[model samples]
Target: MAAKQYKAIGEEAWKNNVEKVNAELFIFTYGSLVVQLVKDFEDYGAVNKQLDKMGYNIGVRLIDDILARTGIDKCADFHTTAEVVAKVGFRVFLNIAPAIANWSADAKEFSLILEDNPLNDFCELPPKAVQEGLWYSNVLCGVIRGALEMMQMQTEVWFVHDVLRGDDVSEIRVKLVKILDEEVPVGDE
Candidate 1:
């Protein structure tokens, strides 16, 4: 019942806020960016880190857009937050709804299973990049980390599986480290 409501909200919000783009163009742009990153860093780890940083920055700003579009209030728990992220956040931004799975016993961690990734559309890692252990979608992890940070949830987000690397399912594992307390600056007080 709750899932259905969230889906409806996501669909309506996406319809109202999202700007439709050609999937091919989006794929081409992302591919070019990856190519440039590879050329600049040479090391796959460094490239992935840079991409994650880029996504983090984007996520920070994206949260504002999401809040404005969805008009969703503060979530009462991490579980609710995760549902919003999976249903509304990704759906509105990427037109894909990922499944939240693999919950921890304490509910402090879970996995997001991405069945369809826009960034992975028409994407194939070059043999050299694969050999160097590059994570092609590292940015997604960073985005989740940054967005959660802004929401006052300290979290570690990382990719655990990638279909591009021959995994049957692409998954991101997010661990809630702690909840951040809102602090007022001394000067402001």
Candidate 2:
């Protein structure tokens, strides 16, 4: 249940348990999806929204996989949640665990700093897309949001710095809105 434990579990899972994939193929597939979304929507904002929605759906299911793989209990707190997300969640899936930083005094917010993003590999945005406020990797934000929602933690995630947007590093800012309580079914309650 500790961060260190999660790190070791992530290493074990990534090395031995998880099925491998061709990074290039995965990247190309994702790239193609983004391109198709752009073509379909013809609007950068809409493309971002679609991508986020797709990611959210993925996240909702992905959490189940993570839980099954790790067999871990609910996160003790947001800080621990951040650690698990950085060390285990990202590592198992992306093979990258971003550095957690810029914590607010309230401890309700933090930033995940990625010096290198596999998603951005060989990806360069067009000037028009940049000008139109398109977040090429907006799916990641939705992923975090959806994953946390399933964990009963409502968090807002957004990209504050993106290498695609010419920032030095890709940073995702996560703010805890509140913890969602378990809900009873209409008839059961």
Query: Cα lDDT of all candidates, in order?
Result: 0.88, 0.90
Cα deviation of 167, candidate 1, in Å: 0.6
Error of 2 at 153 (Å): 0.9
Q: Estimate each model's TM-score.
A: 0.94, 0.95
lDDT string, candidate 2, 8-49, tens digits: 988887897789899999988899999999999999999988
Error of 1 at 27 (Å): 1.5
lDDT, candidate 2, at 12: 81
- Tens-place lDDT per residue, model 1, 1-189, is 276777888899889778888879988998899899988998999998998999899888888888888788877898888898899888987888999999999999999999988889888877787777888989888888888888999899888888888889899999999999988889997
Which portions of model 2 miss their true places by more than 4 Å? 186-189
